[model samples]
Target: MAEIRVDKLHKAFGDFVAVRESDFTVRDGDFFCLLGPSGCGKTTTMRMIAGLELPTSGRILLDGEDVTFRRASHRDIAFVFQLFALYPHMNVRANIAFPLKAQGMPRGEIRTRVEEVARILRIAPLLDLPVSGLSSGDRQRVALGRAIVRQPKAFMMDEPLGALDAEFRELMCGELRALHDRLRATTVYVTHDQLEAMSMADTIAIMNEGVIEQVGTPRTVYEQPASLFVADFVGSPAMNFIPFRAALAEGAAEVRIDDVAVPVPPLREAVEDSELVLGVRPEHIELTDPNEAAPLRARVFGVEYMGTTQIVTLNPAGGGTLKARVSSELAVRAGDNVGLHLRPERLSVFRKRDGRALKSRLHEVPHG
Candidate 1:
């Protein structure tokens, strides 16, 4: 229901910086995700937005109003924690009505709000039960109900599904996204799990070491990572990096890796660094006969079978190990020598000096 903005937001605990000059926006009615590894400052950033923690420097704006120094209670933002923070002494109905009651709403109005939120969350049947006796999943629903009943300007969730088992977490992911769609509320979700972020977020801000690495739609972040850190952190198998030394002029079409001329997407700018890294996703690699002339060659070290595909581990002659996703139907075994062909259009070139991705044709166009 609001647009959230952070400008040069910085946080520090004495000498150690928890967040550094971060900047981003959560458009109104959008499901925005702050994604990263542990201690990457996502939680701190969210807290600042919710008015739970004061930023050491910079500004936080909610719906065009500065709330940087406002108290959490004054922000009109609801926060859901990873552990379902519900009152064990209270029944589900009472728990969900707590916020309205605290606001001194009429008793009848509180009852009406509680019932509406319970119905929306599909938790109406458990309204009379004690929260302590509920299942983890049910308790989580109650937590969500409590937050939803507030009708706040925005909602902030910090890995609300992290307490559930794998199966329940997956199931809740769908339920949560659907709830957002129904409410169309401005939601800021923080999580370290890439799968959750990729599956649920309308836009994702990938963070690391207190810095925002890249912010884009899920497909854009995955297909055209802005930096090396983003390329490795946003994928399951992660992008494979083939390290080599080369100096090239602008518009160069190819580079030599192990004396093999591997075609690459033309560079938009010259790369003066001799140390460069070639990044390719596992699914883009194709295995060919070793005897055939190809850009690169490797020996098959192992195969991991999935239902429709297999992961072929290879030891490239140019050094370093690589994995290829291939059809499981293809016959391949350990110790089999194979030539490797990378899809040229999908290649990413990065400078090792700063771990920054090089500007090239591959990144010039926006990914669908």
Candidate 2:
């Protein structure tokens, strides 16, 4: 296992900048994920660390040894590409031994290393089978074995499971997590899939454009998103951002979104004439009785059943669209006026200008 530190990393192609000055560190034996949409420089960032791409300017350190100018082969890091690149002519065993062979290990040592890695990846049973006939899942396991045979300091996975179907992707996610747990390998997984990062990584770096929008554990990034982009990109169905004016009353604050009037989490100091955003997660909204007090009303527009829970889309009774995941038996069809109860405990308040969190007075309340 190794610690990876990327300091002031930057990448540029002629005139177009692919990555800007960025800094972050991945602890030894941690599963860290770099997440973002296409062309967000995530691949470029990963490549720089692997010595596959030279940073325009910056330093990459492996366990405190500067390796920015080191060759990819000299770095001794494993890379698993999005597509499996197994040699069709070789069997799984041979493929797994290829890395060892390239490193000039003794024949007997190569055989032992290959067998051990195959066992770790649970692909020993198919070692004698030709690589050409393996399923995608099996091929991926073989690819993993091939990478592990060399005993690299770290593993870099670039959407390695992107080729698998949904079911296989989900299954591989679990397998990958378990494998990492067992090996305690320092891993850097790059993906555009937020759900995968949220589920598998110990820490996630949410990148947008060319810079890291936020970096933290999955729970922190999801629960206390540093910015609006992080908030919108990390959650499923995404968090709702209702624009409202913050009104200071006698001792309370009110947020008016559409025709709905809801009490905003009180601010520590009065924020007069400021535009505030009332952000709530879909999972926090509940479908409730029409006569419920202080209920925000919305008409149902769509419903998606996910076996365990149903996603309910509502036409904001005020004027926007809101999505809430409810129980399958909640039973609300399109055009049904449903009341929603916002979970204040999970609600986030953001300033419209810079999307920074507003000061909350929740802790200053008179009683617990």
Candidate 3:
């Protein structure tokens, strides 16, 4: 029943708008993520929800109760910060029990709750270890322990995994997801990493420059981005954006890139022949032999051999550079001339003037 609804929330400091007319809902027990790059107002938005920052104009409702002006302590929400804000003088057990002790809970009750959280986080073995002696990952676990010991209505984690190494961060991502499944605690996690957000969040709100760009499940945002900013930001290696001209061919909307008349999905509305941006992910493009009749020709300028797959960079003869992710087994090398084919169904078209997506064929196209 701990659903959070934000209605037209706005925050401003001096002349700068940190957050702008934001409205979103985090469903009961849902793992929601506020995702965006630095200074994008994600952390600012979370601070407003936690009552750490006052709103300029908006309503914040938790479980049907209005709490816009409530103090942080009164909201009963726990915050796990980006830095492991642990007390170096205290042991793990003491750190986890601090919040309960602050509430005047009995010693016996505090001990019980601390141990329970320690077990859940799999840090029971290190309960007696001083926070100073712990590793980065362990310190993060202890910080989480302190937040969960109180069993707050919702958990607000701001880049809790940012300090850990890459391998350990991946491991923690799985552990955190599993813990969410068990607790089902309404969680608002803030992070700039799209991979982390995509892997963990049940719902994602992508933000940029004091505005929310898009909000949806990971697949929805990745496959059918609403704007050029979203389509470029959400994918790894980023989506390839190339300038093209739109036209009508045989009653279907089409775009020409390097004289290649590629059919595109139907637009929301037709436009006069004009410049448009063609958006496609590297993985969706196929590489072929130069001798073939493919519409595009390119020289392989670079090849990246990722263990699982290879990324091939090409300089198209017509213009801009293109990247294609292919299998490691593909015998492509630098300096090799290749034919490039656009998977028309996988393309996205955007109006060149404003960089807004005009059409997406995500549902109609087949993807791996």
Candidate 4:
């Protein structure tokens, strides 16, 4: 297992810049994910790391050795692409053993390696099947099986679940996570799927427009996003942002929405503005009694009763749609009036100039 380091990486095509001066580290034996939307240079970055795409400038290091100019074969790594690039004619067992054969291993060693990986992936029974006849989920396991058969120093997987249905994707995620726990290889996974990154990665590198926005554990990045882009991408239904002005009301610093005044959370530094943006998660918005005089009152505009909770869309008593997650038994219908309450300190403050969260250590919300 080895740590991977990218320093001042730059990739360009003629006049276009695909990746900027990017830098990050994937710890030894850690599951690191490069996450972003499509055409955001995540693939380019991964290809560069794998020695498939040469950077316009900058160095790539594996275990403190420079492999920036090394050919893909010279670097000890295995890559599982988003598209399952399996050989159509090969049986599952042969496909898994192909890498070993390429290395000129004895037949006895190859069989042992292939059977070991097949058993690890629980695909030992499917070895005789041709690649073309397998389900998308099964095909994915074959691709991963091939990568791990050699026990490469580092593994790179790029959206290996894109071809599967939602149900299968969720199942594959669990399988990959468990497989990762056992292999403990230094792995770099690339995916635009935020949920996948959150669930599988030990460290997430959230990227946008080719530059890394933040690098941290899932919890820190989710609860305290460094910028507006991350806050919007990491959560379900997204965090609600209501632009408003800030001020001192009575003895507390507060944000004013129409006629309502709600106190701002305690911060590490005094805020620089009388005007700011407020960010709150849907789950943080609680449904209160209609008669309770909360700072804000919303009229339910629609309700999506998902199994465990309902996402109630609301138009503030003043106006503007905001989503709040409530219990299914709350018994609210479209057009019902619902009072809103929140832990004021849980509120996130972003600068009006650039939309970065103020540096504050939040007290964890007591799980209900």
Candidate 5:
């Protein structure tokens, strides 16, 4: 296994900069994922690391050696593309042995390696099936088997599961994690799916518009996003952002939203007057009694009954929409007036000017 590093990496096309000065290190034997939306430079960054695309500036290193200008074949890396890319005429065994055969391994050793890979991927039964006859999931396994047989320094995959159906993709995610544990090979995966990255990666770098917004473990990025862009992008239902203006109530800080003065912790005096955006995840908001004494009130606009949980969309009395995730047992319907309760500790406040979290303004107080 090799530790991969990219320092001050940059890529541009004429006037368009596809990647900024990116700097990060993928530890040896680490399952690192580059995650973001389309055109976010994740694939471009992967291409550079694979030696498929050269960077305009910066160096690429493997195992402490500078390989900035090395050719793809010289990088000692295995690449699995989004498409299966298997030879239509070759059977599973032949396809899995192709790399070893190209490297001129002995006939006997190639057979041994092919059987070993097939067994590992649980495709031993399909070893003799032609690629044209294999199912999509099996074809994906063949592609992975091809990569595994080579025993390359690191595996670089670019959306390898994108072509699979949702159910197959979900299964593959778990299998990939298991395979990583078995081989412990360094892996750099690039994908636009947040769930895929969150499920399989030991570390994830979130990219946006060619810039890396945040890099952390799945839980860390989900819980403590560094910027509003990250907070809004990484969640399933996305975070609910409401605008508020600050005020002082009983020597404590308060924010006025839709003419309702809701109490909040004190902000740093410097940013007291800055326009603020209150961010709360749908799962954190709870349903309460709909009464005049309730701090906030809203009318249910819609309800979606998911298998285990229901999503309730409400149009608050003030304006705008808020969504809450609650138990399916909670009977709610459209046009039903309900009270809303914000989980104070779970709330995030950001400066509207730059959409950065107001970490200094947060408190650790218990919620009522």
Candidate 6:
């Protein structure tokens, strides 16, 4: 396996930029993910790293050796596409053995490696079957098997399970992560799915437009997003933003919402903006009775039952609608008045000007 380093990598098509001057490293044997929405340049970034696309500027290093301009075939990197790129004319065994055969390995060696990959993928029984006859999941396994058989320096997967059904996609995610752990292979996976990145990546790079927004562990990004785009993009229900105007000094412990003082984590930086945004995840909000003298009050608008938990959507007295994940047993109904108690330490404050998060104690702690 190889440690991949991308330094000031940039890509452009005429006047439009696909990837800006991005810099991030994929440590040897790490499952790093480039996560973002469609046309956010994640797949483009992965392509550049895999040598499938040339960077307009900057360098790519594999284990300290520069390979920025290397051809895709010369990079010793295996790429698995979203749609399984298999030869319908060949059987699964042949597809798996193709790479080794192209390298002129002995027939016996090819057979051993092919069988080994088949067993690892749990597709040994399907090895002799025609590629066109296999199921989507099996074909995806075959695609993965083909990549694994190469024993390359690293693996680049561009939404390899994107073609499967939701249930199968979830199943493949676990399988793929397990395969990475077993092989200890350096892998870079590209996906727009937050669940996939959160569940699988050792480190995640959140991209927006052509720029890299933030890079951190799944927990770090989810809890302490560097920018508003990241905070909004990473979570399922997404973080709720409550807008207000405040002139807060560093070390201040509270802010006024609708003339009511609400406790917040002490601001590590001063905010002089006429407009600011307070972000809180649904799960961090506690709903209380409106008569209880809580800091914030809201009227329940809707309740979405989600098995063990229900998402309570409410209209805050201050302004804007926010959702709170509460126990399903709580008797919350539409038009019910409720007081919202936001967890102080878990709140994130952002500047509406540049959409950047204010440095707080939550972000100051070194993430493990």
Put down candidate 5 lDDT per residue, 272-348, tens digits, no spaces.
Answer: 56688888889988898665367789999999999799999999888899989999999888999999888765777
- Which model is ahead, 1 or 4, in terms of TM-score? 1
What digit string (tens of lDDT, one per residue) describes model 1 on residues 103-131?
99999899988999889988999999999
lDDT (Cα, tens digit) per residue for candidate 6, span 1-368: 99999999999999999999999999999999999989989999999988889999999998889999989998999999999999999999999999999999999999999999999999999988999989999999999999999999999999998999999999999999999999999999999999999999999999999899999999999999999999999897999998889999999888887787777778899977568888999999999976787767899999999999999999987678898999999988999998888988888888999999988887876535
**Local distance difference test values of all predictions, in order:** 0.93, 0.86, 0.89, 0.87, 0.87, 0.92
Backbone clash total for model 2 is: 0
1-368: candidate 3 lDDT, tens digit per residue: 29999999999999999999999999999999999999999999999999999999999999889999999999999999989899998999999999999999999989899889999999999999899988889999999999999999999999999999999999999999999999999999999999999999999999999898888899888977878999989987889988877654333556777677777675546667788888889998899976787777899999999988999998988778888989899999899999888877677887778777774455455466
TM-scores, each model vs. reference: 0.97, 0.90, 0.94, 0.92, 0.91, 0.98
Error of 4 at 298 (Å): 1.8
- The candidate 1 region of ten consecutive residues with least summed lDDT is 359-368
Name the regions of candidate 4 deviating beyond 4 angstroms. Answer: 247-253, 363-368
Would you give me the overall lDDT of model 2? Answer: 0.86
Indicate whether candidate 2 or candidate 6 has the larger lDDT.
6
Higher-ranked by TM-score: 4 or 5: 4
Worst 10 residues of 2 by lDDT: 359-368
Please give the lDDT score at residue 256 for candidate 3.
72
- Expressed as tens digits, the lDDT of each residue in 1-368 for candidate 4 is 99999999999999888899999999999999999999999999999999999999999999999999999998999999878899999999999999999999999999998999999999999999999999999999999999999888899898999889999999999999999999888999999999999999999998898888889888878877778888898999888887777643333446677868776665665654466677888988998988777778889899998988999999886667789988888889998888898667667777778767765545344223
As a whole number from 0 to 100, the lDDT of residue 271 in candidate 3 is 65
